[model samples]
Target: MILAVGNIKGGVGKTTLAVNLTIALAQQGRDILLVDGDEQRTATTFTELRTEQLGQAGYTAVSLHGAAIRTQVMQLSPKYSDIVIDSGGRDTGSLRAALTVAETLLIPVQPRSFDIWAVDQVAELVKEAREINEGLRAFVILNGADAQGRDNEESAEALSEIEGLEFLPVSIGRRKAFPNAAATGRAVTEQTPKDSKAVEELAALLSAIQ
Candidate 1:
């Protein structure tokens, strides 16, 4: 299945979830292809940095932007079993191209009021994108919840704001290990196995997807 991690808002852990989720899926023995659709190339550079920092090989991360983006993704159909696309922050032609072909659209959002409000815009686009690909199941996954975990008031409020959307129960808590490991081009699973929040959350997410 092709999963596109996207959101219109920045600083909402969209790319982080995209990268780590790809790593988690890869570790599960699945052949993964990560498409970096963002113009910033955050995911692509993060993979390279992590690989060098942890001395591990990074998986395939390609920039699928511009006019030929759709063709490029379609070309990848025969090469990998699974594809995870990291979309740009706002609506763009390339992002639309990705959503057009994606089987499931996984929109990662922080459990905050502001982020919750932004979901409407994304949902509208998801509906539009689905016209071209009816099988696309788009849902919001909570990313970077506060210290109180899922029970936090803000988290609850955020969930309430977006009615009828499937919420992934496993919320990735705000942790330094994620960014720290990313700083060195490594995933939390590789950087600190004992601190299992990142891996556990991602594993739960993958299970939810399957």
Candidate 2:
């Protein structure tokens, strides 16, 4: 499967999710390709750290931006069991190109008014992409959600109203385990002194998408 983690707005944890998901898929013994489609190349950096710290990056990593993302990913798709792309924060050629080839697109949104308002832009993009890639499936997952509040629920409700996005019930809370693990080029599930809640949340998300 070709999956893309993207959003029209930044700070939604797109790279974090892409990197972790790539590692998680590799951990499952699958041949995975991690594509750093974002101009920032954060995913590429994470793979570098993983290689330095662990002596190997569990998955293959590459940097492809703009329309090249579509062409290159299509060429490389047959060699890997799964591919995960960390697209740019905003609507760019990379994101647009990714949408064209990815079978599933996961859009992470924080439980905030600004993030909620930004969904419309994403929906419009999805609408356009579907015209060319009719098989694309877009899902919205809540990220950096507050531990205690109605914000999560409210955001889910708002997202459900959006036509093109399917609101995923699973939410990844604002947990320190995410960054703490990422610092060492690890996923929450692979981190030392594991945070059970964080692991469980990530697992649930993986399952939900499947």
Candidate 3:
């Protein structure tokens, strides 16, 4: 499967989710490819850190932008069990190109008004992409959700109203375990002094994807 992690809004944890998903899939023994479609190259940096700290990144990582994202990913798809693309925050060529080839698109949004508003833009993009790629499936996952509030519920409600995107029930809360583990090029599941809740949440999200 080719999955793209993207959203029009920045700071919504797109890279975090993409990187973690890539590493987690690799840990599951799948032949994974991590594509850094964003200009920021955060995913590339994370893979480098993983290579430095663990001597192996566990999966292949590459940087591809613009129309090359679609062409290159299509050519490379046969070599891996799955490809996870970390697209840019805005509606750039890279993001648009990624949508053309990806079978699944995961749009992570924070439980905030701004992030909720950004969904419409993403929906429009997905609508356009679906015209060309009929098999595209877009899902919205709430990230950085508050543990004790109706914000998550409100966000999910708003997402459900969007025609092109499906609202995923899995919510990843504002947990320190995410960044703590990412600092060492690790998934929350592999972090020391384990945060069972974080691991469980991620596992549930992965299960939903499958």
C-alpha local distance difference test of each model: 0.77, 0.91, 0.92
Give me the runs in candidate 2 sitting further than 4 Å from their true place. none
In model 2, the clashing pairs are: none
102, model 3: CA deviation in Å?
0.4
Candidate 3 colliding pairs:
none
User: On a 0 to 1 TM-score scale, where does candidate 3 land against the true structure?
Assistant: 0.98
In candidate 1, which residue ranges exceed 4 Å CA deviation? 54-56, 149-164
As a whole number from 0 to 100, the lDDT of residue 58 in candidate 2 is 86
- Please list the Cα RMSD from the true structure of every candidate, rounded to 1 decimal place: 2.2, 0.8, 0.8
Q: Give one digit per residue, the lDDT tens place, for model 3 in 1-210.
A: 899999988899999999888888988999999999888899999889989998998999999999999999999999999999999876478999999999999999999998999899999999999999999999999999998989999889998999989999998999999999999988888888999998898889888986
Listed in order, each prediction's TM-score against the native is: 0.89, 0.98, 0.98
> After best superposition, candidate 1 residue 90: deviation in angstroms?
2.2
Q: Rank the candidates by lDDT, best first.
A: 3, 2, 1
Which 10-residue window of candidate 3 scores lowest in summed lDDT?
Answer: 87-96
Which sections of candidate 3 miss by over 4 Å? none
lDDT of candidate 2?
0.91
Q: 1-210, model 2: which lDDT tens digit per residue?
A: 899999988899999888878887888899999999888888888889989999999899999998999999999999999999999886578899999999999999999999999989888988999999999999999999999989998989999999988998888999999999999988898988999998898888888875
Reference-based TM-score, model 1: 0.89
